[model samples]
Target: MHLNYLANIGRYIPEVILVLLMVGLIILEATYKEDEKNRKYIFIATLVGLVATLGALIANMSGKAEAIFSNSIIIDQFSTLIKMVMVLGTLAAIYLSRFSKDIYESLKTEFAIMAVGILIGGFLLASANNMLTFYLGIETLSILSYVMAALKKNDQRSSEAGLKYALYGGISAGLMLFGMSHIFGVLGTIQFAGVAKMIPTLTSAQLAILMPSFVLLFAGIGYKIASVPFHMWSPDVYEGSPTPVTTFFAIVPKLAGIAALIRITAVFFVVDSPMKIGWIGLLIVISALTMTVGNVTAIGQKSVKRMLAYSSISHAGIMLAGIVVINDVGIRSVVFYGITYLFMTLVAFYITSIVQDKYGNDHFDRFSGLIYRYPFMAVMMAVVMFSLTGLPPLAGFVAKYNIISSLINSKNYALAIVLGLNSVVSAYYYLKIVRLMTLKPQESNEEIEGFGFLNQMVIVSMTVPVFVLGIFWETIMNLAAGAKLFIQ
Candidate 1:
């Protein structure tokens, strides 16, 4: 029995490494004076630790799938792939925090600490096989996020953002728990497998009770992904938080939520029943609304961060569209979309962060005539924008294409059409930056010091994948195809 537990621990090394890394950072942070601006060792240590965690996840990818820790968690390629994406997102955000001027120098270390802690939660949530572990994961991710959002203690907007996040999170958590309790009461077990076993056999009375319970349960996951209705806080929080934090939010928690949602849809709805019909109907409505609402609202946003915030919400809707198909192809498409999204989002935010640091704001005008000053960055931004709009021969196009194809294969024509229309609507805002960068005059002749050679190289390198993945996506699609959920 003890040997079995020890083996489970072996499979869980990535999260363990992160926990140890967080503690080490705390101790290292204390050794420095409070006012010290540069903490190079802390940065170095964080990078090394994250790299190690990524390596562990890569190693885990080839292993067999199994439920561990008393079957509360499952280790599988799907969860492992999502974890890798989250780790990569964290790594980028940490690097960005190292130089971003928005965050207080003293608070930078705290950001790294909180980020890793949230990542641990994300890992748990991605693989959670039961309601108990699922709720624990959501709370862990939420509490740290509240602190990270309000990271700029002196900034009133940041404080408001944090408070709003906390209040909403508390309500969402409570409702999710309430729903979970009813589920337990009806099914007599918190285990997801047990719930699945009971779902197909449910009587009409039980189905009535379970349907609403499932909707309530979705509230928690939906909030995390920033889907429509539950997405009220996303733009405000994204705008109010530091750019690095915003970047992290766009990638990690959102993908983690999608991963969990995919698992639930695949597991609970695998067997055909009336409950499956209700769930799919709910996803279809939410997916269309989320996509339309996000795109329509983004058209008027002036702040680049806020625009991206809505953009992310819309992107989440697209990912949800992938889940609506409820098949291996849908799952693979969502995974591929996530991989491409991580790169595009990171590059966009990295450039935006650097530009904001230079200009003291992320307004659209800040990018005016960027091509004249930094043509390479201007082109990179243009490419990402085009890709974001689902243009041809770019990663975003392929990602969107995969999802639409999957939907079409499944005859989900309406949602696919909604996704297509949303992409057109998105072009207005995404291309707005492109037009400003190329058509407008330079804001100033002064060079943005943030675009130093090394930083420029890093941005360019990140953008490389945006192009490569678009053309050579088959390799990645195969990898994504292998990320199957372990259903027991």
Candidate 2:
């Protein structure tokens, strides 16, 4: 029990940061003299918070998996890698807190505080070892995310998007809770291995009472991941929220959701039974349709944020492919895909933030002459788009290769074909954005003023992973393979 408690220390540190940040926010609210120009403090404080969390996580890394709180929470290489990525991702998102439109007064600190809360929850979800732990982690995230999405409370569009999200989020939570009750009632325990171990022994009637509930639980997790058939709220939220906030939605939160998906299914629900294998098939279909639709719909989108939101949903499909396989290959590929995903989406959205700052344009037409004014930024943006399209010599392509090879090795050829075809289709639209940036002519001097120094710093930091990881792809692959989530 003492060792178990010590094992959970990594998971506890992020939450401790959340508490400290909340304390800071309260103190700031009382003492801060609001000067609109002095927003740099917010950036400095947030950067400190995230970097500190990263430092704590780095101190906790090891090759072993350990559990705490009676084995309801786990700390392992899988969760460690995810926690590090999320901390960095959240840090990158908060780097723009100074320029955020919603942080007009004391609220600057609140956004940072709320972001810390979200990070805590996401970390918890990554380490959860039971239904109870999963629900607790997800709700912490969901509660903070609701406030974050609707942070611009004065904006009617933000409020409207919040309402839709609240409705859906509430329903999903209730359904998930109910499912947990059913699982516990049928199996007599909520611990992951407890339920998994009992699965084969259950009588037909018992499984009938629980399997549907199990499916419902997956639905709730899937909603968070924004897979197809339950992905309705994302586009509206992404469109209505600020671009920086939208960037958070595109990267950090989705990584957490995928983490939860991996934990819930890859660790707990896996088996060779036909019924269990059918669930994997469900993932295959969900992944294929989600990716194809996202790529197909992005071509018609005028708003770049909306395009990226759909693009994120599609990539969720690719990540889902990793989870569906339920093996060492799948786990490694998923982690690798996530690392590449951060590079692809972060740089892409960083470009969006830059374009919006310069040209005051979110439309494709505004980017027509971006290359001429900011040639470097334009080229970087084009490379990011190509990587998202899964082209060669980019991290995204390497990620796709790993997933496809894992699928084929797992004998999932039909689904692999679906994944392959969607990658081809996505290239068309990703390149379309490139054409608008380069081949199209600038009708005005919009992009010339878009040199946001803060955004430039963020974009450059985000862009490095794509190239470095592409050149040294083997290193990441080896690390992912070496760090198994459940084999022990």
Ten-residue region with minimum lDDT total, candidate 2 = 97-106
lDDT of 2 by residue, 1-488 (tens): 25556555655676577568667755655566665446565567677777887887777675467777788878777788898988877877776555644334446667777887788788889888888889988888888888778877788877787787788888888888888899898889998879778775667788688778877887788788888878888899888776767777777778898998887776655666544765677788888888887888887999888888888989998999888888878878888889888878878877777666655557777678678888878888998998998888988888899899999998999889999998988888788889998998876764444366656766777788898887798986776566555543
Predicted candidate 1 versus true structure: per-residue lDDT over 1-488, tens digit per residue: 43487767879999899999999999999999989988999999999999999999999988889899888899998899899999999999999999899899999999999999999999999999999999999999999999999999999999999999999999988988999999999999999999988988999999888889999999999999999989999999999999999999999999999999998899888899999999999999999999999999999999999999999999999999999998888888898899999999999999999999999999999999999999999999999999999998999999999999999999999999999989999999999999999999998999999999999999999999999999999886776555554444
TM-score of each: 0.98, 0.94
Q: In candidate 1, where is summed lDDT lowest over 10 consecutive residues?
A: 479-488
* Candidate with the greatest TM-score versus the true structure: 1
Can you tell me which runs of candidate 1 are displaced by over 4 Å? 1-3, 479-488
Clashing pairs in 1: none
List pairs with backbone clashes in candidate 2: 358-450
Per-candidate Cα lDDT values, in order, are 0.93, 0.79
